[model samples]
Target: MSEEKGLLHGVWETVKTVVYALLIAGAFRTFLFQPFWIPSGSMKDTLLIGDFLFVNKMAYGYSYASCPSIRIPAVGIDISAEDFCGVFKGSDSRLFGSEPERGDVVVFRHPTRGDDFIKRMIGLPGDRIQMIDGVLQINGEAVIIEEDGFFIETYEQQGPLGNTPMCMNGSVGIGGDCMKERMYETLPNGVRHAILNARDDNPRPFTDNSGVYVVPEGEYFLMGDNRDNSGDSRVPATQRGVGFVPLEDIVGRADRIMFSSAGRSMFAFWTWRSDRFFKAIE
Candidate 1:
């Protein structure tokens, strides 16, 4: 009987250990930090393809965690891994009571697709946003454009030498390559960033050129840092130009780039772009 009791106690102890480990992991994943990858060039120059980033889940606040009280059983549903990693729920409170600000690089659910998209906040709620002659304007005030040096190409195509279509001299293409002079613009409230210009007479394709858009109270207007190349709020909603992202759909603000890898083949871990490791997101 003594031996049996001891064996039962040992089993209980092992179960407790496993339970404790799982609880700790759940807590960590719930409120500490999370990882995300840059899947598109929308934030190019700041974040590139294959870039792995770490987002501070607690930076805003705790939503899914049992802070004020223990979470009720069965109340928390097992959504997909993405929703499980996120802190908030429903289309409310955005995240942790925090709100997005202009110039913040944020990750939010696509208004149309429900997939994740990362972009810079260019217009806040109730702000008048429009593009005038390829320049961003807010509330009748022009965003200052300061020229940075010419953007230089950093990588080359790997295909056959002549396979890539060559553009006529000074022809701008869909890919935001073909760099020209750039300028840094400081918004009225000190939100300053860079904007690019191709130095050609051709204008952007958007026809709504001048209009006063009062960003709805719960929605935000986002734009890509690569202005000339990005398909963002500048494009009308009908064409799916990221019209207005609801605050509740935001996941978290992008904090920093963890690592970046290059090349079409990612099988080799060493092929990562080592220089961009641990780079802070502006």
Candidate 2:
């Protein structure tokens, strides 16, 4: 009888320890940082599919959309929220940081939908943006782009499995030679990062150029590194691309890649991208 009680007590203790650890981790992820995964090629070359990184939650001031899934255990503070402007126009805003700057790879909730989107911050408040024939123009001046040679990698697509006989997410390097025009683009704020130009493809008419768009106050213009492929601020929010993202919707900045896998699926453990582990994102 005593042995039975001891065994039961031991099991209960183990459970309590795991629960406590989970609570601590939940609080940390909620308030400080959280891990994120890249699932699309939009940020390709910079952040590849299967790249897992930790977003600095405090990089920008904590918006109501900051911790959208974490509920602080025991303290009763629910950081998990999509929008905190409850029953008002703008009620709960600002937690830390001042304003987002150009060149920062940011993660934020979709302005219209709650789905998360990550893109590079291109135009800040009051900045005029235009894209002329695949070239980015800001404030009436073109963003300087210097060719950095060429980049050839396999295109492991992200979609439903078993479709076109192409390599899936976990198997990135299995496809054919996918070549792209690579360059270093300097933003107005002097933030320089790599952007891709698919020479084989033409910029889509809708996203390539239309008219000058002046970013309204408290809003920003974002785009993906894969210039010709990304669906960004150039597209309407209702259509799935991120329109002008509000400052209040930004969640965090992607600083570094924790790890990367080449698998088409998250479960493809065999395709882990060991070379990309702990790589810093410029």
Per-residue lDDT over 1-282 for candidate 1, one digit per residue giving the tens place of the 0 to 100 score: 699999999999999999999888766655665566676555656776678886565655544321212223468833443345344444355345676678888776665654567788888889989877767789888888777886544333322121121221354544535454556778777877665554345456452255666788877888887665566776655576778877765656787888787554445576678899988887
Q: In candidate 2, what are the lDDT values of residues 116-214, reduced to their tens digit?
A: 788999989898999887789998899898999776775645422322212212234546666777889998788989988764334367555668888
Give the lDDT of residue 248 in candidate 1: 64
Off by over 4 Å in 2: 70-80, 83-89, 155-174, 199-203, 266-270
Error of 2 at 242 (Å): 1.0
Estimated TM-score for each candidate: 0.71, 0.84
Off by over 4 Å in 1: 1-29, 62-95, 154-181, 198-204, 207-210, 236-238, 265-267
